[model samples]
Target chain A: MQTLNAMPWATNFWLAIAGLLLVTLVAGLWRIWRGPTATDRMLAAQLFGTTGVGILLALSQAMQQVALIDVALVLALLAVIAMVAFVKRMQGPSS
Target chain B: MNLAFDVLLGIALLLCAAGVFYSRDLFRAVVMFIAFGLLLALVWVRLDAPDLALAEAAIGAGLTGVLMIDAVAHLSAKNAHHQGAQFDQTGARPQLWSRILPVFSAVIIFILLLGAIWWRPDAPVSLPDLVAESLPESGVEHPITAVLLNFRSYDTLLEIAVLLVAVVVAMALKPDTSEPEAGNSKDPILHGLSARLVPPMLVVGVYILWAGSYMPGGAFQGGAILAAALVFLKLAGFGIERLADSLLRIGLALGFIVFLTVATSVMIGGRPFLTYPESVAGELIFFIEAMLTFSIGLILFSLFSQAPPPVAPTSSLQGEQDER
Candidate 1:
């Protein structure tokens, strides 16, 4: 952590990762838009669950905001909960 | 290059916002909104506001997404008999002029806001510097926490009161039907997830509350996490909320009650309301914050759990079904 803090290259690497994750996030949006099933659309939020974590992790390093890693942990937790709620509610007492 | 990344992020946010507003399917719009929330959390990070980012991730992206998705599912199930127009209907397309007029007015308002920003003068007061100067006496190391709990604790008290009031109203609005117990996750996978996740979430919630003394984490964020954990356990099939009905009610208002007591007790010492003595101020803030965290968690969970049983899939011969 100290070495990364001292090195300019580390910042660049993390920034590059963040940028790539953003691109991936935007790419995943297509699945939500083109969804022929509700599950397909929900995959977009799952995409956010993973790629968003990666983005926060990268930016935490790039921006020197360690607090964001906690945010990422939280985002991961909540996103999965959201998915669970979706599945449970969608069952609608029939399943 | 940093500027390029920021601009790209801004564009992505705009795209998600547009997707949310324009999506034809209600489910699609809700998904778009969740995506928008993820982007908004990133934007908060970019703005150097980690506290806001944490709150947004917990409440906006996660909880709101679940609530909206729940509502959408309920809507579909409630109107299950109505074919072709249940989830897709935006209630008839608006007249061209009605849509155009709103957009036109929005553009005009946007330009006026831009002009205001362009002409606004620099403030004479530097609030952050003032906060920093008073930091040592404020009892907490984090400026935001210090300000929120010490210099302006009355506002935090009121915020807790507001949360209490919101939950009270939700309780009132809850249908009179005997509430069915949630947290019966018959799914084995959900069972596994809850067992593993809930403990860590509780630890993280307390850790966040502790971190508020020196970092971005605070009662609201920690409380939200605690609530999420309860929500998780409920979803995982635990039946925890029902098991402790009386305790849950007390937990919902305990924070406000404690806060008001502390605020008034200081009057015996000749201090104004909410002014903690400098000697024990830090300990006092932490005590209040811990209670607030628990109360907040319960309050938020009640809001989610008490929602009108999702209008239930009634009207069939199965109208007797209690669970949504």
Candidate 2:
């Protein structure tokens, strides 16, 4: 039962995660803007999904709740299905 | 000391994210995104969520990477005419203020949220206490297991339904393309690497599934890893057609059917739904999880490979003739 005062590492981890996620936000926005095609934007969205998972994991640690990790898992799984669906759509009907 | 490590990880993550966005070639961008995913998994590990890290690596990084690469290939093939360096220099000249606004807003929101969390360091106690107290009687030692199965079993059930719905929707959207057409080239290096990688991956996936009872690994993580292996095999042109058979269909349905049957039986026994009899609870849980792994693996691989609905008998004859 470590008190808040003793857990400086958790604070540090959150700060680190926030900074990284900010960069991901910037990059993802850039892709959304400069994407020449629909597929590029979709790829960018997938990147955001990956970053979101990372942020969720970091939050789980800071909150000390393992349930948040399950949310992250579900998010990851959903992201994969979304990516595959988009890819198949882009491929179109193969003659 | 903690701040320094945090800053370092943040910087590393930022660099990778930038690489994913700024790369000119679509293929390069996809590869960088995969690298970013791996780094994100590391951050999750650092954040004390090993189960999430596993899922992130297998599904987020591995499966998503494969899908992105496939998309890139498909897109590149369709638009082969516009080939000379796709990144345009002039397009990069956006107004500075326009770029700055979004960044500023994001930072402000982040700060406000962080301040709120820090201000209330003690999360009001009831939920945490409830979870802690109920864990022992839940038939599982891991807190996540307790949360997922005992306290929030209804949510878990709905989550499975959502997964199945997504599969159905995806299937409806994509026209059938299940047969292994001789389209993609075989890279010797990739083939060699996959052969080396897949066996160990299978072993690890199973170990994760069984060890999940005591640790931060589970059916989802294991299934995602197994899906990755199957996807790898498909990408390398191994047994793609065989995967479209009835066996895979049975594997894909096992989890949902077993779970539904057990849950319904509990209701018939005059207890709440999904409540297992005390004597066979552990065995029942393991059975559900094992079936879940197989079902999830097959479903994801089918989704990735876009395996068409199982061939009609006449279509099988056509497929064989086409193969010949």
Candidate 3:
């Protein structure tokens, strides 16, 4: 079998996977919208963060656009900043 | 397959936007807004603009999400403290016309954008070609970097000025009275994670900055990543307050100063401002990007620090001892 990178069919195959990832993100958005607490909303957003990275990586591989990988890397690493901000806010003096 | 993916992305974006707008809870709205930004980054990738994707992810989603979440928390705290006074002074529901006006304007802007897209000229002149044709002379292998730092360096100069002004204004705001309490005794998890996380993030941040010349990563993304790491460290009880007075000040201004000097000095050779000599253009742009990275990081740090959030005090050393 031809390596995925060399095959023309890979783009379509990977794009379908990206579509599925998009569906997962939409489900996460539902959780954000229906949140019973701020933590729930934040956790849903965190889920989107990881899923977004996944979508980018899949596309990066399919399109062979290596730059998308850098974007993915940065997203994965910095994604926690918002969560840190949230927890800190919750634990602030007033809270 | 591509068409289906595009359709899904569009629907997801619309749903996220609606979630941000219609959510009654402000905290949920802010979180939805962040999810919206992440979706927009994905859209940028699909649009074949990885540079925009990077900016959207790092600055648009990551930094802005942090800022807005902090704002939400701060506002709630303030409201709790001044509940009666707040209700008496500003509790009136906005006038109908006042609320309607923004939505009206937003609709108008949306129509105008749609019209612009509809009216796009067939076989439109390729700006990409124009940029590509002159990229080698501009001193960078990446078109966006070349345009940003050399070809249209003035735009970048002004952008840096905008960031600088934002930092200045943020500084002028009354400092938060509550210092982020030191020691993470309440949450040892975050304290341990920060130790393992920050050093590698710093390395990745530097790598992104250095890769900008021929890659999608650039000073803006690099600086934002570094800034995020700093925010994480501060949250975990590491004191960065000492650097704020001196080194941070220098880093905040370094990019603008270096770019301004380079732009004007080139004019001494009887050339237009910011026109680099082809032989040294690459080296010069790299230097400028380096300064820009440092400055961008410092400015973002100041943005977060001026309104420093409270840190959870949990000493990892204590945790280790407890385990032993």
Which portions of model 3 miss their true places by more than 4 Å?
Answer: A1-6, A92-95, B83-108, B123-125, B175-187, B308-324
The sequence of per-residue lDDT tens digits that candidate 2 reaches over residues B1-324 is: 345545666666777676665555555566557656756765775676666777776787557776765665454433443444232222455677866786688799999999998887665668877887977677676677667655686677677667667666666776654454443445465468667767777877787787677667777878887887787666554656465446656776778888888888988889998898776776777788888888888778777766332221111212321232
lDDT of each: 0.82, 0.63, 0.80
What lDDT does candidate 2 reach at residue A34?
A: 61
Using Cα atoms, each model's DockQ against the true complex is 0.49, 0.07, 0.49
Whole-model lDDT, model 2:
0.63
Show what share of the native A-B interface contacts model 2 retains. Answer: 0.02
The order of the candidates by lDDT, greatest first, is: 1, 3, 2
Report residue B311 deviation for candidate 3 (angstroms): 12
Local error of candidate 1 at residue B256 (angstroms): 0.7
Model 2 residue B323 CA deviation (Å) reads: 40
Residue pairs with backbone atoms closer than 3 Å in model 3 (clashes): B183-B313, B183-B314, B184-B312, B184-B313, B184-B314, B185-B313, B185-B314
Give the C-alpha miss distance for residue B12 in model 1, angstroms. Answer: 1.0
Residue B112, candidate 2: Cα error in Å is 2.4
TM-score of chain A of 3: 0.88
